[model samples]
Target: MTDTDVVVIGAGLAGSTTAAILGRAGIPTALVDPHPVYPPDLRCEKLDRGQVAILQKTGLADIALAATTFDGAIRDGKAWIARFGRVIDKRPGGQYGILYDNLVNVMRSAIPPDVTNVVAKAVHIVTGDDRQQVSLSDGSTISTRLVVLANGLSVALKDQLGIERTVTSPCHSITIAFDIKPRSGRAFDFAALTYYPERASDRMAYLTLFPIGASMRANLMVYRTMDDPWLREMRHNPERALFALMPNLRRIIGDVELVGPVKIRPADLYVSQGHRQAGIALVGDAFASSCPAAGTGAGKVFTDVERLCNVHIPNWLASPGMAVNKIEQFYDDPVKREYDETSKSWAYRLRSMSIEEGISWRIQRRLRFFVGAAISAACKIGVISDGDQFVPEGWTQRLRDRT
Candidate 1:
């Protein structure tokens, strides 16, 4: 087996990201995955406002993203002015519907060629007392000083490491997506997240649409629980349920458009955690992944690259013999702290769950409406503070400045 300093399995966000950072830091590294594409396929049709902040902070703001044009929103039956608050993005109004593949292309272009992207299908990972080895299905093998697993889903290596992959939520949902070309000088709005969150379909199904290109192209996301009767109709007759959500969408899209027969993905959350054996590190979803409400996967992985590069790798370089313990300590301490905070934040804001389940869900859901109304009221009442007038650090002044 060939020996290397580090071997990363799976070329999803986490793996590709870390490989890029490490290679830039002058570490000999190899990234392996069967797929040639850098951005792996993603079922998620949208990224929330927070995700945009993380993406821009990571120095990828120059790339293009899909967007819509609306300015205000009706949240829980009340009006609210939408504003973009991400620190890196100066785009004032809202977030973007970045195509998954396009985002990958941007990130890939940023990574250097020295960090080899070996095309191979990884089947298993062996963690030894001193190091690790990734066995591939192609009968090739390589040993490394450390192995970082960034595979996107529940992994067989989790079982080998004695980790449990469990699902907590009972009501599972799936997403169906397709694309349509737009018309004229118009493009989907980039200043707001347009959605009919409370709109209903036959037996209560709903579809979410997002803009994904320069002129006019859209990606639609439809969600339904396993037992939801609307799912059957969607699979059998897709068009009827689609036009109901956006009326002008059909006329603009025409009799047919390019791309997609519609794809479906389970909307359930998966949690996996355990002791990281000495020679291994679990990055990204290999450790835990949440439902749509806690849209932290991409941001979390970006944080992983930042941490491993800035914190973890430097320590290991200072003391090569003490590598395993350094990585494991990161998992137990700072990583877990971040997870706990993020998860608690998700738990508190799940609006659709039972009262006993989400501690502050309803209030959280209604917050957008309240904030929107307050902003409108302030604008109407001529009480706009230019950062100096409102107690020096008031939220309203800060939001206006951020926007």
Candidate 2:
């Protein structure tokens, strides 16, 4: 039997990062995961400036920088945004491109020497008001004061704890990723590019191309069902399907060749119910899920980790028992709630803007592009110093308010 202050299940991005922060603060934490080294998976591969700042707040910025394969800061912090086969705007870019597994491995490595690494599966968790017991597949038991569930999309443990995840939207969106390079073996014209969809019927939200090491990575998010024929065609002939959806893309980026396997992930938006229990806390996807198109996964995860680790945990530890009321405070955190709600709102908004063919939606979509083009023109003519000024006052503003 082993004992610790906190037992973190699932050593992926959320779990590993949580353990890293807690361990750095001198908390006795035990991180449990089946694999010593996380395997490659299709997840958020790009860390935008907002996410970097959030990680910086948690003091994990250096760890993230070290794992990144491509640093946009080195390229003068510029990425082109295009629509209708032409560049529409340029945004400040400190985005980092990295493989999901690579980032997880680096995070796992950063776990302090004193933090115990339990390389085994957490089969069951027994939560109590004063103590918690986590059962590992290796027939080991870990007793702790609290359990941080960061397993992400795994429901067995949650089910055992009687926590239920309500799927708000089924098959909310699909993410397609692949490597691309010009057929002429030459480099792309820009450091990074985000090309918006040409038509609503195409169901594409956007195609983002960014550097990862020596290769240019492409991530396409679409509002499509799982059994859609387009998905089948995409898996069979990704290049053809991609170009068919965005015919003008070839003219803008020049002819390109697809390399490596095309990775696809279908996301479902969900939120956990009955989670405000004693001796347990859920973070990241374990608590809820967001659409990949929203690009808010990392931000949500970072916010949860920051709030739980820096604020709630310290306060919780200072008290006697891990009661339900004490655990509820973390869930009720304003900052954390804002990020979670923003992710949900963005998911619905982006999907509607991309695929909804109603008259109002069509008009709104066109108006959105018109506004973007106008903003681009204004920035070019020095009418506005920053294009971000024209951005709306809702979720975007909330994201910028990191304080």
Candidate 3:
């Protein structure tokens, strides 16, 4: 481990993207994670407009966009997607929906080699009056001026920082996706998130069908059921539950199809009340996230990286010493804005479970609707200054009394 300008703790999209951008910007970066390859993460199926723009700006866009391509209904030309819960039907060149790992590979290749990419977990985050150091599980230390906690929701690391983040309800979520050939007269176009439009359980499950890769595929998400913990036994038992909820899925695949078993995990979305802490900044899911789990974490990570590169970097560079005040200001400003953008869509989806059950939660629903529509319109029209901070126009005010 060496002293670096930045040590990104997680080699996922956010980590890699930050490293790629920072390294290219001449800022030395180190990326840490546990051997980045994982089975394809299915639920997070989108690459957003802002992220698309960021990638394009960074010059890595074409590689990622071309590595994966889709055929079927094109929103603007790709697939229709949702952000903060409102379905975006106007994506130019459509929306991209390839497997999660596929995108990771595309991003990984873009990072400069000078930016060391290590496969290790960050075990301790030590903050001092000066530079910060991160202890790794591998018995190594990597020091940095700042650390970006882009790792998606890891309670362990958060605890290590003495950061007490709320679970905000025991709400958990998981998504499983696989490909299948179409039966005669039956095919699903790669447009719209179709399948489960309503909540089906305390699991609050929903199934979606999309044309992905070489065949027709389906993605299912079961939101926080008491019994199914993703890190536990769900992967092995996917088939058992698959047959129960979707008979068509069972029939379409039959025995010949290669079932890429279900992958489950808690799906609840959360954001820091403020920057998770100082000396460290939490970007993406470690700080802010969106749902129906719209793939906002990736977008947010890029936003964090862009802001760091464009805004934060200039300010930090001009300082003669540790810019504690600047860092703190940077952290606080985003926490407010990130949560504002992330909470509305996800909170609405969480509340959707209440609605389908006829809970008479009218006022909240109306506000959620207004906020969603207004935000969608604002984002579409480019009225919002930062695509990253689209707060669904008056979202907080409308739902002010409810939560």
Candidate 4:
């Protein structure tokens, strides 16, 4: 058996980052994953300013810089934020566009030399008060003081350990991703653009256009079921369906052509139940899933890593054993709880704002956009200093307090 202080299973964003931080702190850590090179996958392809700040705070900002194809900070570019076909604000740089696979690979590469990389699938895990054991498919066993489960939404390992997940909302949201280019053969007027849905009846939250390398990538977030005919139309004829859904988009970006296959990802909101166990901790999607439309997925992951590595794990390691009560402290952490709750709340709020058709919902939707437009105008005319005022009401303040 290999001995280590920490064994992080599933070396994706959360696992690799945890190992990196712990390794830097001179801890005996082992990272377990089957893939030496993370394969191409569809996930959050962009990182916002708030997520970047968290990565920097955790000393993982360099990994993001290395993986990103379009570095807004270095490019010194601005993005146009618009709603109802009207430009709301020209936001400054600090965001980045990156492929999910590249980001994971970069994060895996940054693990310090001392951290052991176990290139095999974890078949089973046994958690105890003093020691946890992990069984790999390659017939190896690793005994460690604690295990951090960052394997995303995979349920096999979680099931072996008796962790249950409860589905909050099934088929919560759908995200459509593809590449686009101007048919006119001319460059777009802006570096990036975010176009909000013109009407809640459209069932779409927004369509974001940003650069990933030379390609202009579009992520259209909608509140729809998997079997919806509209999704079929998008799959069969993405360009026509997209233009039909948002005709005003042509007026802003001019004529555009879809360059590649349209990829659709349907997400369900769930939270892992019975996770407060001995010798184990959950992070990122392993604990709960977030709505892509809310743009809170990366933020939640970064927060989980930051809190676990810097605060919880350090204190846990200084003690004698990884007991159930000690592990519970991280789960009951005020900061982690707040961030998780905020993400869940925002997901439901965005769903209602996009698809709810009641009179009150319509009125509130209009008012929300009106307030956003007002804030944008206020920032333009020197009445307000912070451009983030245009964010959903109370979101900026809550993030400020937490981060």
Top-lDDT candidate index: 2
Deviation (Å) of 6 in candidate 1 = 1.6
Please give me the total number of clashing residue pairs in predicted model 1: 7
Model 3, backbone clash pairs (residues 3+ apart or across chains), number: 12
88-185: candidate 1 lDDT, tens digit per residue: 11112333555566555555555678876778887877777666788877788878877777876846767877877777653444446665443343
Q: Indicate the worst ten consecutive residues by lDDT in candidate 3.
A: 394-403
> Ranking under lDDT, best-scoring first?
2, 4, 3, 1
Model 2 vs. true fold: TM: 0.93
Two-way lDDT contest, 1 vs 3, winner = 3
**Per-model C-alpha lDDT, please?**
0.54, 0.86, 0.59, 0.85
TM-scores, all candidates, are 0.73, 0.93, 0.71, 0.93
Candidate 3 lDDT score relative to the true structure = 0.59
TM-score of 4: 0.93
lDDT of 3 by residue, 1-403 (tens): 6888778888777777777888888887898988767446544565544457655655578878776544334333333333223443322233466778778777888888888878888888888546788999889999888788878767787776776666554554555565544344344333534332323343434455454565555666555554645324445665555555544443323432325554444556555654544467776677755554334455556666666655675567565544457577666567436644655465555546433455454455445445644654665678753334546533332232122
Better of 1 and 4 by TM-score: 4
Q: 1-403, model 2: which lDDT tens digit per residue?
A: 8989999999999999999999999999999999988999999998876777788878888978787855455365568878888886675555689988888888888889999998899998898899999999999999999999999999999999899999999989999999999999877878888898988888889999888888889999998898899899999998889888888888789888889999999999999998989999999999999888888998899999999999999999987999999999999999999989888988898888888889998888777756665654665677764534565433332332210
TM-score, candidate 1, is 0.73
Q: Which parts of model 1 are misplaced by more than 4 Å? A: 38-40, 45-49, 56-91, 170-172, 180-193, 199-208, 215-223, 243-259, 322-324, 333-336, 351-367, 375-403
